[model samples]
Target: MPYINIKITREGVTAEQKARLIAGATQLLVDVLGKNPATTVVVIDEVDTDNWGIAGEQVTRRRERGR
Candidate 1:
Protein backbone atom coordinates (compact mmCIF):
# COMPACT_ATOMS: atom_id res chain seq x y z
CA MET A 1 0.00 0.00 0.00
CA PRO A 2 1.06 3.54 -0.69
CA TYR A 3 0.72 6.22 1.93
CA ILE A 4 0.64 9.90 1.02
CA ASN A 5 0.70 12.79 3.39
CA ILE A 6 0.07 16.42 2.45
CA LYS A 7 0.56 19.15 4.97
CA ILE A 8 -0.58 22.71 4.27
CA THR A 9 -0.71 25.78 6.47
CA ARG A 10 -3.12 28.44 5.30
CA GLU A 11 -6.59 29.83 5.72
CA GLY A 12 -9.71 28.90 3.80
CA VAL A 13 -9.12 25.37 2.64
CA THR A 14 -12.37 24.24 1.05
CA ALA A 15 -13.65 20.71 0.48
CA GLU A 16 -13.23 21.09 -3.24
CA GLN A 17 -9.63 22.07 -2.79
CA LYS A 18 -8.98 18.99 -0.72
CA ALA A 19 -10.66 16.74 -3.23
CA ARG A 20 -8.73 18.19 -6.14
CA LEU A 21 -5.47 18.02 -4.30
CA ILE A 22 -6.01 14.42 -3.32
CA ALA A 23 -7.06 13.47 -6.82
CA GLY A 24 -4.08 15.18 -8.36
CA ALA A 25 -1.70 13.63 -5.89
CA THR A 26 -3.15 10.21 -6.40
CA GLN A 27 -3.00 10.64 -10.13
CA LEU A 28 0.63 11.62 -9.93
CA LEU A 29 1.46 8.49 -8.00
CA VAL A 30 -0.60 6.31 -10.28
CA ASP A 31 0.64 7.77 -13.53
CA VAL A 32 4.12 8.93 -12.72
CA LEU A 33 5.07 6.83 -9.75
CA GLY A 34 3.42 3.72 -11.13
CA LYS A 35 1.30 3.17 -8.07
CA ASN A 36 -2.29 2.07 -7.68
CA PRO A 37 -4.91 4.39 -6.29
CA ALA A 38 -6.69 1.53 -4.59
CA THR A 39 -3.61 0.79 -2.56
CA THR A 40 -2.58 4.41 -2.02
CA VAL A 41 -3.48 6.36 1.05
CA VAL A 42 -3.58 10.17 1.13
CA VAL A 43 -3.69 12.21 4.28
CA ILE A 44 -3.90 16.00 4.54
CA ASP A 45 -2.96 17.92 7.63
CA GLU A 46 -4.14 21.50 8.03
CA VAL A 47 -1.95 23.45 10.41
CA ASP A 48 -2.53 26.75 12.11
CA THR A 49 -0.42 29.87 11.57
CA ASP A 50 1.63 29.15 14.63
CA ASN A 51 2.59 25.78 13.21
CA TRP A 52 4.05 27.28 10.07
CA GLY A 53 6.69 29.91 9.48
CA ILE A 54 7.64 32.08 6.53
CA ALA A 55 10.77 34.13 5.91
CA GLY A 56 11.91 33.14 9.40
CA GLU A 57 8.71 34.60 10.82
CA GLN A 58 5.54 33.00 12.12
CA VAL A 59 2.45 33.36 9.93
CA THR A 60 0.30 34.29 12.89
CA ARG A 61 2.31 37.49 13.22
CA ARG A 62 1.91 38.33 9.56
CA ARG A 63 -1.82 37.86 9.73
CA GLU A 64 -1.94 40.12 12.76
CA ARG A 65 -0.12 42.82 10.77
CA GLY A 66 -2.52 42.26 7.81
CA ARG A 67 0.34 41.42 5.49
Candidate 2:
Protein backbone atom coordinates (compact mmCIF):
# COMPACT_ATOMS: atom_id res chain seq x y z
CA MET A 1 0.00 0.00 0.00
CA PRO A 2 1.12 3.51 -0.71
CA TYR A 3 0.00 6.57 1.16
CA ILE A 4 0.14 10.08 -0.26
CA ASN A 5 -0.55 13.22 1.69
CA ILE A 6 -1.36 16.47 -0.12
CA LYS A 7 -1.60 19.77 1.67
CA ILE A 8 -2.79 23.01 0.18
CA THR A 9 -4.28 26.34 1.14
CA ARG A 10 -8.05 26.37 1.60
CA GLU A 11 -8.77 28.54 -1.40
CA GLY A 12 -12.03 27.44 -2.95
CA VAL A 13 -10.91 24.14 -4.37
CA THR A 14 -13.77 22.32 -6.01
CA ALA A 15 -14.77 18.69 -5.38
CA GLU A 16 -14.12 17.82 -9.03
CA GLN A 17 -10.61 19.21 -8.75
CA LYS A 18 -9.98 17.21 -5.60
CA ALA A 19 -11.24 14.08 -7.29
CA ARG A 20 -8.88 14.68 -10.20
CA LEU A 21 -6.01 15.16 -7.76
CA ILE A 22 -6.81 11.85 -6.07
CA ALA A 23 -7.01 10.07 -9.37
CA GLY A 24 -3.80 11.59 -10.65
CA ALA A 25 -1.95 10.73 -7.45
CA THR A 26 -3.24 7.15 -7.52
CA GLN A 27 -2.22 6.81 -11.15
CA LEU A 28 1.23 8.13 -10.41
CA LEU A 29 1.79 5.49 -7.76
CA VAL A 30 0.48 2.79 -10.05
CA ASP A 31 2.73 3.89 -12.91
CA VAL A 32 5.91 4.50 -10.99
CA LEU A 33 5.86 2.03 -8.13
CA GLY A 34 3.38 -0.52 -9.47
CA LYS A 35 1.18 0.01 -6.47
CA ASN A 36 -2.33 -1.35 -6.40
CA PRO A 37 -4.91 1.35 -6.85
CA ALA A 38 -7.29 -0.42 -4.49
CA THR A 39 -4.69 -0.31 -1.75
CA THR A 40 -3.28 3.14 -2.39
CA VAL A 41 -4.42 5.94 -0.13
CA VAL A 42 -4.42 9.65 -0.93
CA VAL A 43 -5.29 12.26 1.64
CA ILE A 44 -5.66 15.99 1.08
CA ASP A 45 -5.54 18.58 3.82
CA GLU A 46 -6.74 22.12 3.29
CA VAL A 47 -5.39 24.68 5.69
CA ASP A 48 -6.41 28.26 6.17
CA THR A 49 -4.17 30.77 4.39
CA ASP A 50 -3.47 32.39 7.74
CA ASN A 51 -1.99 29.09 8.94
CA TRP A 52 0.16 28.55 5.90
CA GLY A 53 3.37 30.54 5.67
CA ILE A 54 6.22 31.22 3.32
CA ALA A 55 9.26 33.43 3.62
CA GLY A 56 8.26 34.09 7.24
CA GLU A 57 4.97 35.56 6.05
CA GLN A 58 1.52 34.04 6.24
CA VAL A 59 -0.11 33.13 2.94
CA THR A 60 -3.02 35.39 3.75
CA ARG A 61 -0.65 38.34 4.10
CA ARG A 62 1.20 37.43 0.92
CA ARG A 63 -2.01 37.29 -1.03
CA GLU A 64 -3.07 40.61 0.40
CA ARG A 65 0.28 42.03 -0.71
CA GLY A 66 -0.16 40.42 -4.15
CA ARG A 67 3.06 38.51 -3.79
Which stretches of model 1 miss by more than 4 angstroms?
64-67
Tens-digit lDDT string for candidate 1 (11-57): 89999999999899889998887997998889999999998999999
lDDT of 2 by residue, 1-67 (tens): 9999999999999999999999999999999989999999999999999999999989999999887
TM-score of each: 0.83, 0.97
**What is the Å distance of residue 8 in model 2 from its true position?**
0.2
Error of 1 at 14 (Å): 0.5
Question: Whole-model lDDT for model 2 versus the true structure?
Answer: 0.97
Model 1 lDDT, full chain set: 0.90
The TM-score that candidate 1 achieves is 0.83
Give the lDDT of residue 26 in candidate 2: 99
All models: lDDT? 0.90, 0.97
lDDT at residue 67 of model 1 (Cα atoms): 83
